[model samples]
Target: MAEETDHESKTEAATERRVREAIEKGDIPFSREAPVFASTLGLLIALALFARGQASQLARDFAPLLDDPRGFALETGGDAMLLLSRVALAAGRFLLPILLILAVCSLTASLLQNLPRFVLDRIQPKWSRVSPMAGLSRIFGTSGQVEFLKSLVKFLSVSVVALLLLRSERTRAVNAMFVDPSQLPELILTVSIRLVSAVAIATIVIVAGDLVWARLRWQRSLRMSRQDIKDEHKQTEGDPSVKARLRSLAQDRARNRMLANVDRATVVIANPTHFAVALRYEPSENPAPLVLAKGQDLIALRIRAIAEEKGIAVIEDKPLARSLYDAVQVDQTIPAEFYRAVAQILFFLFARAR
Candidate 1:
């Protein structure tokens, strides 16, 4: 029990990936009451529109048997079968529209709750589902208790609604009791319509409430653990620490390569201590001076030390060194905006060499 509690505590709000995976597995929030409500409402509407017509058609179909029972007798068995088939076909035709309405309502309710998606996993057999212990636990669990309470509430509420509706029409019922038997059917139909309509309306309200509650419960169930969220992030964006380490290694390799290129540069310009930029110029091979390497602070100190060791000219030009380091990249030709400044520096160096 303590382990179970700890596991439950680890889970928090579900991540998008978790929710999407659950959807793919056919795990979705749904309220069974939604379809029942839709079907009941549709049935009530269908009855209101076609009940009288259906009753008249039924009376017509059965009237022959009632008026002249001897006429149904036939010499051949096939004739009797044909007569029965015709009656059955007529009944089916009459009820087809109502059945269609109920079917459409059920489908619409299902679609609204969770849009259609084909997932064969939902239909696949699972041994755990068939386990007797699991079945018993499900029947005696928290969900079962909630279902039982809901059933009891529905029964009591419908009973109260029915009693109220019947009491309201008691006077008419009493009057109808004394009327001709033929009038009794009409009176009963009227009372039934009122009772059913009230019940459907009440059920719809209950179903709406249940749908909200069910959705909240489903969301809670999908909550994920902190570790699960981190794992998903690593899968999608990679582990942050690993990425940082790789970046540091890449920077080190680039810096080593840059230091090696300092030997090929014609001059190393420095801000004395804070900045360093090594420039290479070959008038025959290139039109403008190229930045061979650049670095700042500690790296700048290392660049100056390497230049001194290699016997390369190290010029301390604060503004030029700072501008080169900020604006130019290694292996890139100096920009046109810095052309005059770079040209003067190169010319001065050539004169000094001559």
Candidate 2:
């Protein structure tokens, strides 16, 4: 009941991060029946194409030993060993193609559903994997029950197919026993082709249904709650509090650098208590005077104090101080629009210096 409630609570689709992490952990929708179906298909193909030829070849190769047993004698260990080697080589030659076909088909089936990825976490030892409760939960879980139903369906379908084929060919099967030894291979190949083809046809439906079910279950498992999305957003972007704190620290460092440069100002414009803008001018250095520093309120007071300690000139012009602080940036030339107001200030300061 609690599990169902939890499942219901997760209404949102899985975020990209969640999906990526799941894949990194080797969690993917894979149909077990697909590989089984592929192996069956491989068997059917090999039986149809290669089985008749190989069986005949093997039969011909063994004809001497089987047809006239008295002609061959294993008198010594060397003779026995040689005979065993020949048998092994012949069996391997007959079976190698079938084995290769099965392997390729199985791999292709798996790759069609999900690409391969190596994840150590998948193979790592985990207590939950071996836990009794976990094992039982898996066995009795809805997913397990669904799998059981699928397996039951596949088994019944394949069994019915086998039974029907056997019933229909019961006479032929009995008569096969009495056939010539050389003809036995062809008869066996015919029966195998029929049985494998029937089984393959019957299980195709089960495999297709299982593939869809597996994908649905995997997607359902990935569903996230609203809170989960919020938490992931914080992790991927950044926490609000931490970002604010970082912004604060950056502003403080910039202010300190500005104050340190205030000592180099030729003059400081101030509202006496609220605003300050420090300007530095030299005919050879820049086309217009550059503001060395500007600030309001507490920062303005700090800039003024720094100027006073360095013995730099402080001019009180409440209106001009406000405008300069609004429009000017430290280390940047004052705007051309402010040229008249600022040139007048420099003229008065230069006259006072003389």
The residue-by-residue lDDT of candidate 2 on 192-236, one tens digit each, is: 899999999999998889999989989989999998998999999
Instruction: List ranges where model 2 is wrong by over 4 Å.
Output: 1-5, 62-90, 259-264, 268-276, 284-287, 296-327
Per-candidate count of clashing residue pairs (backbone under 3 Å): 0, 0
User: Which digits, one per residue and each the tens of the lDDT, describe model 1 over residues 51-107?
Assistant: 667756766776676667788767799988978897897788667888998999988
- TM-score against native, each model: 0.86, 0.81
In candidate 1, which residue pairs clash? none
- How high a TM-score does candidate 2 get? 0.81
Looking at model 2, residue 149 earns an lDDT score of 93
Off by over 4 Å in 1: 2-11, 74-80, 163-188, 336-341
